[model samples]
Target: MTADPLRIGILNLMHDKVDTQLRFTKVLSEGPYNVDVQYFYPQTHYTSRPVPDLVQKISQPLDLKQVATMDAFIITGAPIEQLTFEEITYLDEIHQLIDVLVANNIPQLYVCWGAMAAANYLYDIPKFQLPEKIFGVFHNYLRAQDPLLKGLPDGFLAPHARYAELDIDKIMEDSRLVINAVTKNNFLFSFRAREKNQYFLFSHLEYGKDALLKEYLRERNANPGVEYIKPQNYFRDPLHMKDPEFSWETTQRVFFDNWLHSVADHIATQQFVKE
Candidate 1:
């Protein structure tokens, strides 16, 4: 008999709600297993302004009961990295969601700032502001082996577009955490706490070919007077650059394929024990 579809919940926290959802769905659909993807947003996120029509149409309120039904969960990064963690309005709800997911032993993936938030909240590792943003495709080397990195190469490229860096030393020191990948500059690329069934990825492996270019152009257009640097290792010709080389397509596909497989394996194990 065929198995049930894997239920995946994405807690959408990005400003570009539609585009963020598209990026995740595009990568996830390429996997072998059948998946039911749902989008959710923090209930406290829209207290000041009305919810956007597109967000309202695409997502539902982040109810804890609904979150418990998912086989796995993903929390996307937000643009509020500069703000103190306590200053974030929806953090209490996020913490509660994390509690529920942890209580249920559900697999969770936290991306970029979401990862930073998790590290801060769960492990007390803080994120530090950098002098300049790390806004480009960077090389990451495998630091340790895990099922999630099954098909990934020893060295691979992924996109990093953030202004803050997590405390690498603190993460490395944590006995419960496993450091999987890191850049030559010591930036933590990926890590996990196997006991908690939680994973963290600092780079944007799901970004589209022109994702960085579009962000660059939009930022420059919004601030015409400020000098902005083009994303490093992105353009074929720096002088006449319009498009980015989609070098990480293979990495993106294999990583998500491995992740889905991992989740499927977990589900099968649970079913076998119950039977």
Candidate 2:
């Protein structure tokens, strides 16, 4: 008999193009599991308001039933005020999703803003505000060995875009989760759900090179006079932005490949069983 395809539900919290979901699907599908993606937009006031074209294009309500049918679910980040979960218009919907996922013991992966959402929902911790926006490729160091980081180098670079940080102390306070990695800025890089099959990443492991430039341009346009006008000095000169080699597409692929491999065992166990 042929093996069943792994049904993967992608909860895209952002109001950007579906490209983020597509990139994630591309990487996860490369492994032993067959992947399927479904997007969910939280029905909240903030999302409903008029916003950028990118946000409008990707906004839609995601059915919860999709969560029940998947072997794994990946939740993308969103742009919102992170001071408190209440401030996020989709706060209730996110909480509802978390409750359902936890009840079903479903495996999940949260990236960037998704990570903050997971952290807030899981720990009741408030998100920290940044003095400035965090953009470009940032380096992360594995604090300990974990399945997600297996076969990967000690340090890896991934794209990031946010102005809020999570409280590591509060995250560590929860005995159910494990901190897998940390950045130099003392931010959580990666974390795992304690009892349930869930993993969260605060970095954009699925972003390609072009995506980074696109995001940079978007931010540059959105906030022209922000204090941090210049890109991070660690990356190559932005003057060579046209070059494809400087893109982080390869890094994104590697990160996704490792994540897929890490979840292979779980995928096998949850493979579709015909009635």
Candidate 3:
């Protein structure tokens, strides 16, 4: 008999719910575990607005009372990088969710802005704002060995589009957090807290090939005066903006697959101990 599908809770802070859902499904599909996703949104930020039909299925209010118990969890990036963690619309609610994840020892993947928030709220790690957005597919090197990045090449490209930096020194010194990957510029690429069963990625590995281009165009159109450099090592031609390499697709798939497998192993181990 087939094993029951893993229930994955996604604390989706992104505004574009449909696009985010698509990227998540595309990546999770690569792993062997079948997933039942229940979307959670902060009520203050999203309110009672009706979600599209596609989102309606998986979406639910981020109610602390419901307290979703999941096999794994994923927190999507938000555009609230400029604001302080406490300044976010639903302050206590988000923290409550994070607290639950920690208290329950749930395995979690925090991406981009979500990673920054996790670092801040969990460990009191501060973020530094960059002069300009670090928008591109950057070359990242392996900092240490970990299951999530095991099969990846020595160095590979990961997409980033953020305007702030996490305190690298603090994370490095923390005995609990393992720095698995870092960029040449000292940007924290990925880190996992084994004891807490949490993973953090500052880059958006689930981004589609055209995702960066769309971001560039949106920024340029919105603020004509603002200088928006095209994402580095991304476009086929800077002028034409054709042909993205999609170099990170496989890495993205395998990363999530590793997490799923790890969660499965942890559950099995617990079951064995009980039996």
RMSD for all candidates, in order, please: 1.4, 3.5, 2.2
Write the residue-wise lDDT of candidate 3 on 1-275 in tens digits: 11877778888887567788888887786577887777787766646565556555657777654554677788999877877776776767777888887777678789999999888888778888888788888888998998988788877778998888889889888888889998888887899885778899888888888888877887788899988777888877767878877878877877888888888887777678889
Model 1 lDDT at residue 151: 79
lDDT values for all models: 0.87, 0.68, 0.80
Model 2 scores a C-alpha lDDT of 0.68
Top candidate when judged by TM-score against the true structure = 1
Candidate 1 root-mean-square deviation in Å: 1.4
Residue-wise lDDT of candidate 1 within 47-142, one digit each (tens)?
A: 898987888899998989989989999999987887888889999899998889889889999998899998888999988998888888888899
- Output the number of the lDDT-best candidate: 1
* lDDT-better candidate, 2 vs 3: 3
Q: Which 10 successive residues of model 3 have the least lDDT summed?
A: 46-55
lDDT tens digits, residues 1-275, model 2? 11666666777765455777666667776655565556666656455576545554754466677677666677887776445666676667777887777787677788877778787777765678887777666677887777767656666766667778887887788888789887778666788877777788887777665666666667678888764443453345556655433444556666666665555566556555421
TM-score of each: 0.96, 0.83, 0.92
Candidate 3 shows a clash count of 0
Task: Give candidate 3's error at residue 183 in angstroms.
Answer: 1.0
Pitting candidate 1 against candidate 3, the one with the higher TM-score is 1
